[model samples]
Target: MALTATGMGSGLDITNIVKVLVDAEKTPKEAMFNKTEDSIKAKVSAMGTLKSALSTFQDAVKKLQTGDALNQRKISVSSDSFLSATADKTAQAGSYGIKVEQLAVNHKIAGTNVTDPTLPVGEGSLAFDINGESFSVDIAATDSLAAIAKKVNEASDNVGVTATVITSDAGSRLVFSSNKTGEDNQINLTATDTSGTGLTDMFGTGNTTTLQDAKNAVLYIDNQKVTSQTNEVKNAITGVTLNLTDADVAKTTTVKIEQDNDAVKTNVQAFVDAYNSLVTAIDKMSSYDKDKKTAAALQGDSMIRSIESQLRSVASGRITAADGSSIALYDIGIKTDRYGKMSIDDTKLTKALSEEMPNIEALFSTPGQGLANRFYDLADSYVKSRGLIADRETSYTNQQNRLDDQREAFSLKMDQLTARLTKQFNAMDLVVGQLNQQSSGLVDRLNSLPGAVKKS
Candidate 1:
């Protein structure tokens, strides 16, 4: 006979007993590996958060490290319509009387009018002289007025020349304009007709009218004369760029360049904000709640502790001031409280900026001893490739990989144990069924020999 189902002949739940035994052997080991994997993943995630916070702080530090941050200038013009201006750090703080006499213009010319745009002009080559560069386009007899204009625009060697068609009461005419400004950058056109197809007659040398003349911009600054080929004038005053928009001989606009104290204050505030955010992030990661019996992911981590310590030191360190007195962040109104939180005193900060602006800037950005430089260097070491954060993440990843291998091995072992247990229990059930059969045969033989009446 075929083997009975598991536990059927023995009247015992052999399958369930095997399951209980297998679970007892496998559950605790799997739980341990899973817990390790979770801990490693949390560490990797915490490292990512730390790197991001450090990068934000680094950006703010870089802004303070530049020379422009201290020497920034603001420009104001009396009339934007007359002229607009911008000044850089090199510009001196002063006022200048600016009078724009004339704005630079480009040369424009229109061809003689014709009845229709499609009408053929002639069959010849149209030569152009633009800014001393010479190029030409061949004209066919079948080429219309518009067609000739298209050919002129499509010329490969044409420099500073644009062609268009204009229709007025005088009829259809081709127009040409110079892309450059100033009198020296004029557009001159001449046509040659070999087949005498009237192409030269339509757009020849005499068939054009000067619509606008090219001229340079002329201006006066504090009684000093200035001329520019274009409206945009650079270096008219050192580190100042002037844009002359309109001409007004009788009106004058005053241009002023001055130190931008407000901008500097704003930059300082941004730095403070970024610094505070990073501090808060670090604090949260390293905090502990005694009452709740809970700790943060990076609590007690040596690397994180070291990073926080270095950052705080840089913030509070003293640097040699211009007047030989040591200065630090507190002198500039950036102060930390007992709990390591930062707060800015606006009144004190503004006063310090107004009185000792240079000293304040120098205190935070003075070469190797500068706060920003030290902070940036520290952050870079942690965030850059092969840095502290990267190495920590690598360690966690390796741990996770090992845990994965252990889990795979445990699963394989559990599977083999289950198969072996099932086979052993099935063999025990078969033997028990054979013993029951033998016992039943012996009982029937004893009943038959005792001459006992058949009790029904």
Candidate 2:
């Protein structure tokens, strides 16, 4: 870049003049551009904040809309040592005397001592029939006691029984244990061998001993005998399941099912808390500061107003309950204050839930028109694609882009202005230099012509 010639003849600062002029043309518009850009950015950030708050509220709304929070049930036990009980929504509120008789045991059997586990025991097949299902493991004369057990355990078609070899000073023996517990599930093994089989002699010679007997779990409910193949007993009572851990023939306990109050209260309170939180967020983004006389980023935003109004209408409207009865949020103690914030009256809510929980559940999960359903729908409108909040954010982003374009154009304009000013000022300086030279020549010519007496 060529340097600008300052006022050589006219003593003017040409560069400084160009700069001041260019700044004069640029300052006001630049300030406006930056101010508009900042405002748009602020609005974009505010929209994101509102969208996030809407999502949080929707998370709480989902539980109620799906009836998970409404239908939650808890289990209680009378004597945990002997038995435990779990109840679900289908369980009727009632009590029953429970007496545990005997716990089911798995069938176990063992063969007589084998001189050596590593020596071959048999040469054909050891077929096991357990719980009406049968599977077999082929044996070879060279198959050892350990090998037979391994073959049985590793057979892909084998069902319930497991084979193992037990070695002790008493001698080495092959043991079989049944996976299922029932009289019918007793371990029954059939041996077919070619070579003088060691297994047939150990078992066919009446050397196999029954280690434990297969028996069903027996319990007496109100003195009515009940038997199960497993410890867990279901549907002995409607929606109630009994889990037996220990059995005592002489001891008695009780199974009780009742409505859970604390869980219902907690769920209602969560909904209220979520609503209040959204209210706080809305207020913050749309509030005006009196001391500073400044409005917030989203103040007077029509979208925010519309969202709050729609949700408020849903909350205040009545829901058509299952029994053809209409119920409102306030009927269950969910009230909205003048500020449009939700609050709960604990006493009123507890009474409503305790007296009519079915109706309350219906109020929040009545298919399409419940409070949770309506709120989720409304929030979705604002948070989904092309939603009000999303559209607003897009608008602000577009504004930011346009501002950038204008700023670039303005920058080019300032550069042009500076160039023009510098050119004009330099031209003026040249003219002044020529004029000073012409004036000096005239004085010199006059001094030489007439008896130009020196000023001295």
Candidate 3:
């Protein structure tokens, strides 16, 4: 609104003066608003970190609640070349002797070779019976050996038979094999011709060459006989699956299923690590730095203080055991230091695990009074949707939005004030310029009179 040559008329830096005055009014208010915004944002970030730490702690708690963690078993085989075994929670801890007598084999039959594989055999339907399930493939007069094999393989309802053409020094022989390994799963084929005798001439009604004989796997478990139609023998032993790789009648492999101490120890250590990390995060957020004269973003926050208090309470509390005794973490070799960090003693932990494992599990996994269950419930209240953390974040976001609106309104007011000040200064400069001109003219006129030029 003011003239671009602001100070040219009055010889005064009016534009700089207006800028200095406006800055003096605007800077302090804007700084206060920015500081409030930063503090709110930092609090929101700290809440997010708290939520993440709680989630990690909850995950660690979940591991101790499952039966698999408490009853884990590790299987060992003396000779892995013959077979390997896996044991589950239901398996009893014992050693068993296993002898592999024979492995199951699939039945395979090959038809006699022909002069030309591309030559059409005949228009017929080839039928097969596999494990009491019957299926057929329609053969056309123009269908070659390869085409017939493809048709047989493309049959969706085919139970356990696969057909292929094998090329040897003799010729390409169409072979059909049973996918299942058992005497009951033999592949028997019959051909019903319509036009020519090519089907009977090639494979002959009863002259199929046997490539492999179907047989059952025979084994001895602790000198007891066991037979299976498949190499994978399951249910022969409770919670154990024996996968036979080879047959060695003279050798016996010992399979030992025992409680997996290392696995349990690893899980315990993981829980300890998770707990320590969560405690460390909470401590940092809630602490004050006296040397720097600054407080953490979450310092003096009631919700954060409550969370830390509950977690520490759970860690220090005890649980009632099945023997009517109270068991604490320290009894199981898990101890907390002066700084509230937890650690495990390897030797002590192993001994406790061997002797008081059930009691230790009860401390963390007992139905409703378990330490893990309590921690899980507490953390869930904060990290869940529409929970404490979510509500706090929403409040902070509202504050930021209000700050943004205030900033916009403040800026508009400052612009209006600046424009008004500029216009006022320009009008004053114009008036001052006119006054100076009139004063100069009066001096000149007086000098034109007599004795006006004598004064120095």
- Most lDDT-accurate candidate: 3
Ranking according to lDDT, highest score first: 3, 1, 2
Candidate 1 TM-score, true structure as reference = 0.84
Per-candidate Cα RMSD to the true structure, in Å, reads 3.6, 4.0, 3.6
- Of candidate 1, the 10-residue stretch with the lowest lDDT total is 197-206
lDDT of 1 by residue, 205-307 (tens): 6777999999999999997889898999999999999988999977889999987988988888888889889989988887898999988888899988898
lDDT of model 2 at residue 64?
A: 92
Each candidate's clash count: 3, 1, 0
On the 0 to 100 scale, the lDDT of residue 360 in model 2 is: 88
| Residue pairs with backbone atoms closer than 3 Å in model 1 (clashes) | 121-198, 121-199, 122-199
Off by over 4 Å in 2: 1-4, 71-75, 105-214, 384-388
TM-score result, candidate 3: 0.84
TM-score for all models, in order of appearance: 0.84, 0.83, 0.84
Q: Is candidate 1 or candidate 2 better by TM-score?
A: 1
Instruction: Summarize candidate 2's per-residue lDDT along 1-456 as a digit string, tens digits.
Output: 222466886788888888888888788998999889888888888899999999999999988987757765676667888998887777778778888999888899998886777877767777888877999888888988888889988999888888889998988998999988878789888877667766687665377889999989999998999998888889877888888899998988877777887888898889999999999999999999999999999999898888878878888889887889889989988889999888888888888877778888888988889889989988888898888777787888788888899999989988888888888888888888878888999989998986778787
